[model samples]
Target chain A: MSFINVLSREINCKIVYYGPGLCGKTTNLQYIYNKTNPDAKGKMISLATETERTLFFDFLPLALGEIRGFKTRFHLYTVPGQVFYDASRKLILKGVDGVVFVADSQIARTEANLESLENLRTNLAEQGYSLDKLPYVIQYNKRDMPSVAPVEELRELLNPNKVPDFEGVASTGVGVFETLKAVAKLVLTEVKRQAG
Target chain B: MATEPKRVFGSLEELMTNPQMVMYEEEFNQIQAIVVRLVKEANARVVFVIDKNGQEIAKAGETDQLDTTSLASLTAGNIAATGGMAKLLRENEFTTQFHEGERANIHIQIVGNRVILVVIFDSKTSLGLVRLRVKKASEELNSIFEALLRKVQDPNRETPFAEITDDDIDNLFND
Candidate 1:
């Protein structure tokens, strides 16, 4: 859901980054935070354990260029990826406008990816949302890893929807904006459709 | 009002563009004047009027540079979550809350029975003054908003989004 301001002619949407543990979910946000123009973003807040994995979520708000007359803002968040933090993940998914499923491309983490995806479907169902129906996308992350699964195989298994999937090395910001833009676009389009 | 459940708009745009578009220049000015007066009367450094969904409509003092959007959204989320908690506990609603920190204190009150009024202040303002001022402002705001709703429900009002084309929306996706 979005918070709309008629005075400012703006809409704010929440987009969540979700995936399994150590899947670069937090890293994606950090990279974007580091590279974003200072004027375009607010302080990035990370609720993390001592080990640096997200505890609840990581929040970063980005201002994309305006659409029509309204300034489009997206609040990006990453859920704690560990299985034990399932409760926190469900809490973060509340009121989400769109989702970016960041998958660890490493071959060793294939089962982890599948498990996380299943968890996502289940949690979304609990909240009365469906992954297939929502504006959802997949990001095959950590492409730099030599042990990562091939893009084709990852697509076949994870992105059957063909929603704008990206091959990303988030730490270096290769496909970070691409992924962000894809989700932001989907969210804004959804807003327009809802308005009409 | 009837006991029928309040509708939940699935998205921000939907809520803003609902057939019940409730705003006009006169009410807008009235709201701004009331906010300015309320801030001064309350002796507060800042005062903001956030929509029921937590979108900042207008603010007075110390708010020009702040990202009110994020704050408004979070406030809305907090209120919704709190309201849900109240229902779970079989209560009516969570009316208000106060948070006092070392350097600053915040008074968050629900106004117009729909919006939230947030006053951020320091030692410059007293709690008594803030409460008295907010009480007065809330009543005035409540009436103005009720009239604004009637204006919104008028059959002659035009929609802002009626002119937008699908291609324009698609262009937003062209990265």
Candidate 2:
């Protein structure tokens, strides 16, 4: 859900990054946090375990400039992608304005990607949100890896709706901003539509 | 406008996502004043009023050392987790939570079930004093938000975003 505050002249939206275990969901957030200007970004918080694996979620508040005098602020969060973390994943999706599914591009993890996608759909449905209706995008992460699955294969399996998919190497910042920009644009467009 | 009887509360998500829950500048100032006063009365280092979706609506007191953005997000998450637990236990909702650290303590409570109020303090004051002050502040805030919601729900009120165009939204990301 997006909070359009007329008093503060600010629009706050929540966007969650979700995928299977170790699919670079957190990397996407860390890359954005590292690249964003200090003034444009707030402290990045990660609720993780001793091994630095995200236990619950990772949150980063970003100011993506303004629209028609209203500051556009996006709260970027990443759900713990491990299979056992389904409960936590459902919690993070509550009131989400947009979603970016970060799929691991490695050929070996294809099944994990598909399972996680199904999980995402089920979890979203539980909250009365349909993936087909929400502002959603897919990111084929770890694209730089030598054994990564071909883009066509990944899309064939994951991008059934063809909702603005991107090829990304999150660790190196490749295609990171493009993915963020794509999702943010869609979310803002949704906001406009809702207002009308 | 006719004033409807106010219910006990609704989910934070429902209140926040409602297009009618508009906050005007005048009402915001009133809320800020309440928070500022609460900070003084509680003798706390900081007080933050945040939407349940993790957006900071207003804050006061010493926040330079704090990462309020992250704090707000974490606080909401904590509240949500607790609320979930409450549901599983067949309770209405756990509207209040307190976490005490060695040096600082955090007091969190749901106001009007729409926003979370967080008070961060240290040894300067005891938890009892903070609780007493917060009780009074929550009541005032509840009424303020109640009026604001009624104003927002007024059918004749103007919507600032009503004039926004698709191009206007597209232009926002041109950078």
Candidate 3:
């Protein structure tokens, strides 16, 4: 859910980075946190287990400058992609405004990506939301890996709806901003259409 | 805007366009003041008035060492997990939670069934004193948010983003 504070003249939207475990969801957040100008970002928090796998989620609050008189703030979150963390994933999607599915591109992880997308659909459905209708995008991540699936194959499996999608190596920041920008645009556009 | 639980959206367009939370400047300042006073009275290190959706509406106290953005998100998750537990146990909601650390502790309270108030303190204050102060603060905070919800639902209220254009949003990413 987007929080539009007329008093502060700010728009706060929640965007979740979701995918299977170790699909670089956290990495996408870390890269954005590292690259964002200090003034434009808040503290990036990661609730991870001892081994560095995200136990619950990672959060990064970003200021995307102002459009007109209202400042736009996007709260970026990443769910624990491990399958057992289904409950945690559901909690994170409570008021989500947009979603960026960061799919692991390695050939071996295709099934995991598909399962995670299906999980996203079910969880959103439980919340009275449909992934088909939400402001959504896909990032074919880990594109730098040698065994990465062909973009065509990844799209055939993940981009059935043909939503705005990108290929990225989140660790190095490639296509990270593009992916974020695409979803952010869609969200703002949705807000505009709704606010009218 | 009146918190009508059964209100129909009419169509997906209505559902997709409606914002979940709205705050006016005057009310935000009022809530901010309450948070500031709560911090002083409770002798807490930091106090956060966050929407249950994990948005930090207002904050007070020394937050330099604190990652309040993360704190707000985690607190909401913690509360939601507890709420889920409450459902499983056939209870309405837990409403309050506290986690005691060796040196610092956290006290969380749900207010108005919409927002969560979290107080982080250490030896600087006792739990009893914090609880007493929060009880009063929560009541005040609850009323403020109630009014906020009503105002947000007002159909006549002006929306600042109504004038935003695609070109304007694109400009933000230009840099």
Candidate 4:
């Protein structure tokens, strides 16, 4: 949930990055952590297995300036994308203010992406949340990969609702901020909508 | 206070069902006071409160040497993991956790099932003493947050976000 601190003039919101295994969910967070100014970011914490796969989640907190004099902090998290990590994935979404579904565009990973999407919907539903109602965006990551599917095909599969979607190579940082900014804007807009 | 079954929801439901976890200045001061007192009463190095989602609500004591943001996030994860295990074991909720180190230790308690109360201590205090202090502090903190929730539910409460415009949001990322 969004934590609005009137005494501190700050707003903290959670945004979760989710997708299939090897979909570059952690990569997106790493890129953001690296590029963020030292002052605006907290230390990035990754709870990973010995193999470097996210065992639980990856967390990065960023202060993206202010809105109407309130400092805005977004705690960005990425679920371990492996199928067996469904429980961990569900936990990461506990207080999410927004979501970025980072679909690996490779032709071979389409099924994994769809399964993860369905898992997202069901897990969200269990928490009394509907994906259709949350501030959400989609990113077709790994656009630079040779075996990736066409953006059009990926959109038909994942972006049928046509939320703001980006073509990203998260490791290389292309479309990273665009996807983040889109969801962050949507989340703030959502909080504004609630404010009224 | 009658115990209510805990229901976890994300921001969407949190906004629609209850208000966002909006902290009023009045409630903030009360919470800060409780935290400050708890540190001294328990002979602890640090005492902080966080939402189940890992947002640091308030804290007091020797925190200058701590990365509280990371600490807050990981603590939540630890609780979430344990809470999952609780479910698998058919328990209502674990509600309390303790981890001991040679020099520093932690005690986590789920307060009213809404927030996590964490105390970090050292060899200076006994676990029994910390637990007693936390139990008393949890009740007080719970009442304050309960009042804060009710205050936020008032539809007419003034929020700075109400005046924020689309342009204002856009300008934040203009760089």
Candidate 5:
């Protein structure tokens, strides 16, 4: 749910980074937060367990740039991917304008990826949103892993809609901004479509 | 802003997905006026009108020292979490939340079941006064938003993004 403040000349949108546990969703946000210019980003807030697993969500607000004259601010968030946190994930998607499903590319996590994808669809549906209609993208993260599945395999399993998928090693920031830009672009384009 | 799942208007997709809330210049001033007036009537240190999604629509009173962006996000999260709790207990919604701090207290109200109205104050005012003022402010805010929504959904109305070009979007990533 993007908020367009005509008086303020600001467009605020929410994008959620979602995947199974330990798929580098937090790392993806951390990388973006670390590399972004201070003026472009706000404080990154993480609600996590003592061991650093995301407990609720991680929020990073970015002022990407102006679209025409409206300030395009994207609130980047990552859900706690642990299965039991389903309730939390649903809460975060309430007003989402875009989605990035960060898949762990390791062969061992293939089932987890599929299950999380199903969960994502279910949660979005609960909020009156469908994955196909939303501005959604997929990232095959952890490409540096030795046991990673081939990109072709990840695609066949994850990118059923073929929505601007990317290959990323989030720790090193590979494909991080590419994924962000891809989904953010889709979000803006969708906003325009809604207006038209 | 309403914690309840939206009641579909035309298509469920066209319902909530399009413009969840549109802030035009007209209603913006009315809403701002209510927020500003609430601060004075409630004797609040600060007042913020935030949508359920955490976008700060308007604010007044002393806010120079606050991290409003972060506060907006966290407040939405707080409301959503409590909304979740309400569901499990089989309640309609928990429309009001109060958090007392030693120095500054926070009062959050769900107005018209659509937006969050937050008032931050200290020892200068009583909760009774704040609540009474918020009740009046919430009614005014609700009517203004209802009008804004009616204007937004009118098929002939202009869209803020209608004038945006492909170049404008591409330029966003040019950095």
Candidate 6:
């Protein structure tokens, strides 16, 4: 869900980067936070353990271009990728206007990718949001890594819904903005439809 | 200076016309007082109230620099979504949610009839004090909101949105 504030002429939406452990979910947000103009972004918050594994979640708020005089702000978040963090993942998906399901493309992590997608469905349903109905996209991250699953195979396995999927090397910033823009576009389109 | 009344009217007129809305004035005053004290006593930077739909009802303290309405709306959505999950999974109500950052932290609690109160602060305040202060404020707010909801539903309710025709809504689309 998005909150459109008529008083301040701004719209705020939440977008979550979800994937299995070590699938580059946090890296995706970190890269964007680093690349975005300082004025357009807020402080990036990461709740992680001493080993650098995500403890709870990561958050970054970015201001996209204004529309109809309202500042379009997207609160980007990443859920802990570990399977044990199911509760935390569910919490992060709450009120998600759009989702960027970052699937690990490594051949060895294929099962993890499938499990994470299923997990996404279970979590989204628990939040009363249907994965099929909501504005959602998929990202094949860590494509640059060796032993990666083929993009075609990954798509066939994960994105049966075929929602605008991208191949990204999040650490190097490849396809990062594309992923963000695709989700942002879908979200804004939802707003237009709602208002109309 | 002259903007105060207009600003209030602009934000407050949504549900203000009902004959049963008599408590609105008192409730608004009370909420304002509680928020002011929370900010001062808790050493908070910002405090605000967001309706179930995420609209900003009233806000005080360090709100001018940021977009309260958007924050309120998004935060409300977050609470509502999580609240919905709690209901679906047969869990108890989610009382509060907090997000701690390097420089700032937000403390949010669900109040009467699905409304949310959010306080944003930094290292200046302790979470224990903020939580206690918010708990007290939430109880007081719950009653006021309950009364306000009754007023909203009191058969004698008048809706300004009702006066807005389909054409008006369509015109919003055009612009």
Best by DockQ: 5
Off by over 4 Å in 1: A3-7, B1-31, B51-54, B64-93, B110-115, B135-157, B169-175
- Candidate 1 per-residue lDDT over residues A67-116, each given as its tens digit: 68867778888889999988668767766789999999999999999999
RMSD of each: 5.3, 4.4, 3.8, 4.1, 3.6, 10.1
Q: Please give, for residues B7-59, the per-residue lDDT of candidate 4 as tens digits.
A: 34555535544447788888999999999999999999999999889999999
lDDT digits (tens) for residues A1-196 of candidate 6? 5655444556677788989999998999999989989999877777799999998777788888665466778888888999997877886775577899998888999999999999998887765567777678998999898798789999999988789999999999988988888888777666554433
Q: How accurate locally is residue A145 in candidate 5, as Cα lDDT from 0 to 100?
A: 92
Q: Please give the lDDT score at residue B76 for candidate 2.
A: 88
Docking class of 5: medium
Give candidate 5 regions above 4 Å deviation: B1-18
User: Model 2: clashing residue pairs?
Assistant: A1-A95
Candidate 6 ranges with C-alpha deviation above 4 Å: B1-46, B50-59, B62-91, B94-109, B118-175
Can you give the DockQ of every candidate in the order shown?
0.20, 0.36, 0.48, 0.51, 0.51, 0.08
DockQ metric, candidate 1: 0.20
| RMSD score of candidate 6 (Å) | 10.1
In candidate 1, position A188 carries an lDDT of 69
Better of 2 and 6 by DockQ: 2
Question: How do the candidates rank by lDDT, highest first?
Answer: 4, 5, 3, 2, 1, 6
For model 5 chain B, where is the 10-residue window of minimal lDDT? Answer: B1-10
Error at B82, model 5, angstroms: 0.6
The DockQ score of candidate 6 comes to: 0.08
Q: Of the candidates shown, which would achieve the greatest lDDT relative to the real structure? A: 4
Off by over 4 Å in 4: B1-18
